[model samples]
Target: MSYPTISFSGGSIDRADYIRTDPAKLEELKDWRARLVKLDGLDPVLTPQNELEWGSLADCPPGADLVFLGLRDGRACFAAVPEAGDAGALQMGSRARAAMGILGHDDLGIYGMARSLVDWHARHRFCAQCGAPTQLAKGGWQRDCGACKAQHFPRVDPVTIMLVEHGGNLLLGRQPRFPAGFYSALAGFVEPGETIEGAVAREVLEEAGVTVRDVSYVASQPWPFPSQLMVGCHAFANETELTVDRTELEDARWFSRAEVVDALTGAQGAAFTPPPPQAIAHQLLKWWLQR
Candidate 1:
């Protein structure tokens, strides 16, 4: 029996496709009269900490913006924003710090969007068209420069994470900063002008010196640590010989199914376990094992 890549089950909610393109929904969200509220943690709905009590398209503060991510249940789903300084402060608080490990996908999505938008606003305070400060427009979806009339939108970065398997063993590696015995799948930011498959192959070869074939998409997760979407994949190894790049990996090896099972079950003497359930890496490994 071979070790399997884990799969995400609980957090895998199929966001319906209709939310993005429907004109009515978009119009409703874009309406100036719509009500938008911010929540601290999972509180139902609380007023925003800023002075802009009501949602508006024209007066969002610098370093404050929203990422309009379509609709959830016909109500516009958005990543709300506050000041970047405030975000950092929140992270330093005991509650926020504790939530980092406990937050689910939805919570992480919100946090990511909020933080990234704030960062974007911080950097884009001045318009690209004319070096003048821009104003938030369209419910925080776009920013407009008052001087030259330029608009900017939020961005999402794509990253690839893959589980590589050959024969009955799955490949895993530990980073220099990782705790002893800790290992996860190889991952890297997807370079510009490269497909997901290309990124996976490239990352595998570069980090583990392993040749891969039959690359297959597994799943994707929104990792908002700073606005990244993790594209999970599984690739069959064409060559099993290990030659880890010391600069990237402190250690690398193949783990059998039984070994992985023991680690997951916390049996004595097992190596470090995967990340918490909130992480896609854990899901990927769980999915692989069940299959």
Candidate 2:
């Protein structure tokens, strides 16, 4: 029996790290039936057919940087950047969320990987150590500096997003940038020395002025708007009333389970709405409501 994976988490792809380093395998990669994802200025190109859009290795521009992504259905998958001189009507499109309806979950996840990696490479063209130009190595997974022989890999920031509960009520807050009448579980970035539990409690108290305990993990998601891992959790608030920190949140309040249920189900007289299913916050809310 197969268990359900998190949204935007699972793909039927093997990363093939061992094969990525093999010269013979690299030659074979150029011949396999492959799916090519190209980023034209951070947007993925999609075919009119509404599929992920594949291209032939022979069609790839000469001397283009190709990164072996993985093997999908026993076929190779690669990510590349279009050449400035190549002439093709590459239809530029929005990121995954904007085009979620047409894209598969695995496609979205793979797109996230490609976007994160390509963006990282663009940002770290030079070595942090020795200030030397770095070359792409390990099939776009690693960068090497000839000056210092230093190697750098892509970095992923971790953020903790947790829903706080007290008694039968759930605590949620909204930032000024959020849409009106929309709120989500409070979240903050995990500091270098802080644990996930510590970040959860700290964020709750800092944002809502509510102390929390009994922190527990719910799930995690790969948020690739520049590469972040969202750590989802549930915590029990010791207080019911909220002292909203105006700087962090526009307002915060506790909502009864009935109110949340109404909001989630789009019942009449609903006052607020949570995030969409594409986000881990939505999954956390569903888990909490089901319990």
Clash pairs for candidate 2: none
- lDDT per residue for candidate 2 within 99-217, as digits (tens), equals 65677788777877776777677677789988999888888898899999999998789999998888888888899978889988899899989999999988888888889999998
lDDT of 2: 0.78
Question: What C-alpha lDDT values do all the predictions have?
Answer: 0.66, 0.78
In every candidate, how many clashes are there? 10, 0
Best model per lDDT: 2
Q: Which portions of model 2 show Cα errors greater than 4 Å?
A: 1-5, 58-63, 81-95
Tens-place lDDT per residue, model 1, 1-291, is 343332222222223345444546656665654334343432222224312122444434454455454444455544445544334421234443345555544544454455455555555667887788888665455688888878787667888999999987899998987767788889998999999999999999999999898999888876544457789899999988988999989988999988888887889998666666666788788878977
